[model samples]
Target: MATGWLCHELYMWHNTGNWAQVFPPGLTVQPGTHAENPETKRRFRNLVEVSGLLNHLVQISPRPATPDEIARVHTREHIAHIKALSDAGGGDASWLTPLGAGSYEIALLAAGGAIAAGEGVVSGEVTNAYALIRPPGHHAQPNLAMGFCLFSNAAVAIRHLQARLGVGRVATVDWDVHHGNGTQAIFYEDPTVLTISLHQENLYPPNSGSISENGTGRGLGFNLNIPLPPGSGAAAYRAAFERVVIPALHRFKPELIVVPSGFDASGVDPLGRMMLSSGAYRELTHLLLSAARELCGGRILMTHEGGYSEMYVPYCGVAVLEELSGVKTHVDDPWQPLMMAWGGQDLQPHQSLVIDKVAALVARIS
Candidate 1:
């Protein structure tokens, strides 16, 4: 099992400036490191190397996605807007989303990294791959950038696969603790791609990711949203996969599986209220791998998304990578025991109700 890793140093250079968490500095908000800073991604990369896992994977290089490539999913005006702002030494892309000089170029590279990872998996260059690119992109819309995202990386890559790579059906499994509004909207009217998001209810981007927000037109019933309650943990997530996600995949029968992977659902993450350990993420990956092997010849590609915990994100990332590559390293997550023992780790009746409701939607996929 050759798992490919795609990353570029410049990915860490796409600066979001000094803002307190998600806010710009003001009289009330003091200047501090942004929650979307590079440390979380950098630490994930560092652990892969320090734990000897890096040496076991295939390394794929990223190239800048051309304007034509980006045009597949973004509007011309929106593309030019980001470039203009980036050229003028940086400015806000949207509410709570800031960028520094040269960020536009880096955003292009981030989208390109997604393309590279997808290509690696589709072309059989690697059995599976993970692109650790930055400037998280799932929150970006066709003409607006928000939620710390500048481009819809996963959406752009899925478009490229359909238009240029001759691939037909693709499915996205987004577990970001926030709604994947951008990806959902981009493919909302098309049935070729199935977008399933498991997120905290009403967490980010207000009034989004509702269970009733299924697909539209020809895409009706193709999109599924599992808005788990705020305190959902390992058992809830596992039950979601077993009951809803995996069955939807079996019904859709996609040729490739793309994950907008995010670790923000970690118990200690300041941005979310879910209680999940690295072990839970490992199990999720295991389930996905089994489904991919059975349905898609083991073709899976993942691109990084929102994960704000600088200390714990690396452990979750390493666990997923370890599962993908089938290699074990000496590194063990110190926080796992405590996270697994959290009060809500067991599946509660309330969580089961939500899962049961979403599971009924699976029969509508075909």
Candidate 2:
């Protein structure tokens, strides 16, 4: 029942500058609104405040992830590039995913938190855990940070377990509404680590995750990508898990499960067209919990991914935390706002096609 929270002060140290606003913004009021640390802090604090499970949380103070630790999953050249960018000025404006002043410490803290979560799982300090890490990690590749991601946090954790803790079989499920191309690439040729990314296709990073981009060499079939179209709601995500994710895991039977948690799939979020609500996140967490209980010794580590709607993301995040910690917290309008969204702008025929296409694609895959 112990749930380790690999959180440090630097989780919110990353401050987005003006560049992200110009290219592709985040999920809040406008594109660049969610780019600020205060926005993430506001919503994240809401979830923690309501949950009352703060007692169960483990606070990992800020610290740097060593170059060797990073190299476990990322390419040395990529690391060098990011370091140069981080050091050149204060941010990385080229990709619109800039880092603010003091962001270097923040990135280290985020990376450290993920590694701490991995340790928690290995040492049996918790049945499962979630690292409320920031500077989302799914979009980061071995050498670069795209899509507001600075490091491949989940992939790095996997490498830590394999090299540092001697874990053999590891699996990561990324439900970020965008493809986890970086994670897949890190373990693309490694059979020991399995990555399952079920995302809304054609969203960001246009052509990243496709069914045909399965793993290569020894890692063949270890990487599974289920790309859902826009507007896919609770049903599609859950069905993908039951049909493809769970089945694959049940058959592969890994020792640990990790989720790159992202709430951008919520209906209110501007980055995505998915109709998933707070309730949907809870259900998805429940499904993962069930699978973990049945297969992977109930070990799960969810590192923060993406979720833009400041108002809505907190609610959805709280919902998932509630399911994970078995803590029932009551918050007002949490469920109402998202439910309201589905009925208002989400049901338009154009959006509905997105859901239908996702369903058809899943049918083809599973």
Each model's TM-score, in the order given?
0.99, 0.87
> Model 1, range 1-366, lDDT digits (tens) per residue?
799999999999998998999989999989999999999999999999999999999999999999899989999999999999999999788898999999999999999999999999999999999999989999999999999999999999999998988999999999999999999999999999999999999998899999999999999999999999999999999999999999999999999999999999999899999988999999999999999999999999999998989999999999999999999999999999988988989999999999999999999898
Runs off by more than 4 Å, candidate 1: none
Q: After superposition, how far is residue 319 of candidate 1 from its true place, in Å?
A: 0.3
Location of the lowest summed lDDT over 10 successive residues in candidate 1: 337-346
- Per-residue CA lDDT of model 2 for 100-167, tens digit only, reads 76665567667777888878877787878878887778888777778888788888888888888878
C-alpha-based local distance difference test score of model 1: 0.95
Q: Which runs in model 2 stand beyond 4 Å of their true positions? A: 20-38, 58-62, 336-366
Best by lDDT: 1
Candidate no. 2 TM-score: 0.87
| 10 residues in a row with least lDDT, candidate 2 | 357-366
